[model samples]
Target: MDAHHPWNMIPLPDHTDLNLAEIDVFTIDGIFSTPRLDNESELGYSDHHENDLSTPVPSPVPTDTSTTKETWAETTMAPPPLNRRPKARTLRNEDWAPVKDRVLELRKDKRKRLREVKEMILTEFGFEATERQYKWKIDQWNAGKNVRRNEMKAIVRKGQIRTVAEPDKRSLTFELRGEVVPKEKIDRFMKREQVPFDAIYSPSSGAETPADGILDCWTPATRFSVGRTPTPSLSGEALATNEHSFFVHNISSSPALSSITTLATSRPFEGRSPRLLHSPLAVPSSLEPNDVRLRRQLSNLEQSFGEGSEPTLGTLLELCNFLLVHGRYSSAETTARKQLAACRSLYGDGHERTGMTLSMLGQVLMLQGHYEDALGVYQKAGVILKQTSGPKSEPYLRNRIEEGVLFRCLTRDEEALEILRRAEATAQQVFGRTHDVATYAQLRLILPLVELGQFLEVEERAKELKLFYSTVTPTSQSRRIIWDVNHSLGCVLLRTGRLKEAEEIFKSIWRDAVEISGPEHPASLSYLHNIAETLMLCGRFEEAFGKTDTCISSRISVLGLNHPDTQASMRLKDRILARQRMVSRVSHGDIVQSGDVM
Candidate 1:
């Protein structure tokens, strides 16, 4: 703490060339000092005269006035006043601790905007932060919460945590389209446990025998497959072995069982699909939206039926559909796998149930952009359905429509058009043109036509479908179909450069979806995205940026941050920003050029 030390001294003025005698130095103890001058007497003051308070030192009679004036001017001139530095205010842990709970509460109140929350925190708890800082802190908190929640979910998935009660023996019944099956039938089906495949195989006869042929009569093959193909005869050495050993050999060596075994053990999306490898929009495992009631019900069903039971398979299928409808593709894929496993174990390969499950799995895979894997799954499903349900059946036709959609997604327009046309014709033949199934098949054809650049054909078909739906009394299913048709029409308009019309259509679709499913639903978000894209194309950068940002945030909450849709929105946001920058530059350049001309 030495006063003369550089650290303790006052900082020098910015101008280093100033004479030291002209600068006033202030010490730490409030004393003013200056460098000693060699000619104080010449300036009309003396050191000895400073000691006498009453002695009048005579002012020098104006001798050499010009020289004295120059010296006084130098001494009286002041260096520029030091600028007082502002203290930097930083947010500290202590500062955040007091306001954290209130800030989070305000955030949860959807009615409160970020600016309002920041203002409330500042007013109530004296927490100071800029908009950006406040948003960053909240985001960090949310990220940490997500990590902890995911960890708990992982533990629950591993069976280390049981959030539901133990299974009850009471029967559970599922209502399908306002029809309830008899309790006796439901209980009987639910109580049927999975038996080992070897249990149904007999080696004593040494002849090929169909497994569970009697059980096949209990259920319709169209609903669920109960029949297994006849097993091939075993050699003499195989017959001598134990039943378990024989079962192992049968699974590994049998050509019919090879596909089933491979499906059960191998990952459906192992290798990258050629078409999706470098695609920016390739789908990943999207996060499921939080639905406490549905989740609780699913958990109870799982506990009640146990794994590998027929009821479990049914429950898994329901869960998969729920996930898919909510745009939770990744979760749907996982649930579909469980559904497939249970189907294979209970109904065996080549069962109609297995085929239907495979079809659903293929649809999920296709949505995730695994086109190759989906194609293989679709082929397997087609073969099984052809054998069990015939090509003319509704399930087969639906599967074909989905396959055609997959082709459309992959941009294989010609192939998609052909397949979709055939499916539509077949659906019309089987179910009639006005039937819901046939109408859906027809509605799906518009997108492929649009992709093929057949805009006129697409517009005509869209009008026909729209007219048909107008005449029919509107139900939830019909409304959904109508929305889809309009969405396709909007796409046609968008691609054809009718930006204003497309934007209006997308906005209408968004409003309808919000009314039907609420604002946070995936369908609503999708329509919102369409509007955002249309706005971007129309050069409305500000509106487009805001819409795209909201879409990205909603998708992150519902479908997860890394989902393809969210990624696509982020890309759109970047493009919007780039366009805005370019526009700003062009306007600025114009101004500069105009000024130069003036």
Candidate 2:
């Protein structure tokens, strides 16, 4: 079955026409009112009047019997009188402009009757209008205004624009939250908007060529062992100088980009990892602390790196990784951009290296909640990789996964589901269903389906994953996959209001994850949170509160107080407490009423 076609489109309720009551007066007493009967004298008077009216009434004029009979037949067979009133002119967009203000005023006041409004419209504007047309116009005006208002508010909140103006006079001078927007970023924006690039900068200044010296060293490489660093195969035969090798070798020594398997194998569906395609680690606290040793190492690298040197790219990548893993996404984004610029300078836009750096920058943008920008970057990276590394390559698949994630974040659930479904098929065909790439795609596919309220499909996919893992060796990775599947299924159950089943699943998953990975692990915390929610829904308020407190404390310790998970736990606790108070008040009121009745 096509996953894309599985989504159920929930139709909105049919709209009923507005029915206005004709009578102004209504009373319950009218139904119970007694009926009065006429007395005997009044009945006798009515009989006397009936007797006096026995005389026959006569016609005013005589008529021919045959002609009258013919006329009667003609009258009986004649077609109904034609509706002689001319049809009203069809309404147009420009025609509506004249009455727009009147429609808006009447709608805002909402006190005038539709009949009165219609009459007023005909009298004042010389146009016959119906109540339905008036209502539709009002709705259209409000919807357009609301859309613009929401869009402006979003732009303002993101600090993308300083102020919102009228639609006729929208301002284009962007006021970025920080320093100037990069040239690449602006170029991308311009291209999307279909603005002429020549209007901003000349082709000479906008386009940069890849260094010819860099591409001469391209060579096929073998996969390395799991524990060993994966080195680029820049063979001695292909290299013109030792400097390139030194730069490449130095880059490999820095913190290995926690491989894709680190994401697929270990990180559960929690924290930023759930949103990311290949997050290095689940939480920031686990990243290496920035101490004197790290500072000295960076200082030494900076001292050795010269302007326009290839080694600078390695340094930039290091800085970007450190910043990103440590939750400094804004700084990481800047550094990633710098690294991308350097990569482009060396390897050009279409090179695999440039595509990788671009994908990294997109992830950083995602971390910072710039989903629109991140989506654009992900698309660019995907295109570059598909052109240079083939569509079946791992990088391209990863790009699709990240794009799906971004689409999900942006609340474009159907789009996310479609992209993920396509990617999953590709992964299954290219890498096999059991491979980590396919598994990752399968996992990501569940998220958007859940958002779309397609719980059955979610459950089916989840069950398939569980069944697949059941046959495999119970490695830590396999266990994690099973754990994630159960967690997601439990979430679907919770959302579908199967409180008891969901609670049981959450308890079992939480217990097992805690035993395996400890309470501080993101997976355990997530399951614990799920338990709290299920408990609350089941009316086990006290237990829910206690569990939530524990989850929040653990999240604070493991992730940080400002982490979204910790804040969400705190909010859930507040809601649970509020519900408890409300239930208590209602119970007390019921008891008081019972006592009074007794």
Predicted structure with the largest lDDT when compared to the true one: 1
Output the TM-score of candidate 1: 0.51
Worst 10 residues of 2 by lDDT: 260-269
In candidate 2, position 275 carries an lDDT of 19
lDDT of 1 by residue, 292-338 (tens): 22444455554576545675666567767865665555446655665
Clashing pairs in 2: none
lDDT of each: 0.59, 0.57
Query: Model 2 scores what on Cα lDDT?
Result: 0.57
Give the TM-score of each candidate.
0.51, 0.44
Candidate 2 structure quality by residue, lDDT tens digits, 485-581: 8888888988989888998888999899877656666668889998998888888998998999989977765454655568779999999999899
Output the worst ten-in-a-row residue range by lDDT, candidate 1.
Answer: 240-249
Q: Pick the candidate with the highest TM-score.
A: 1
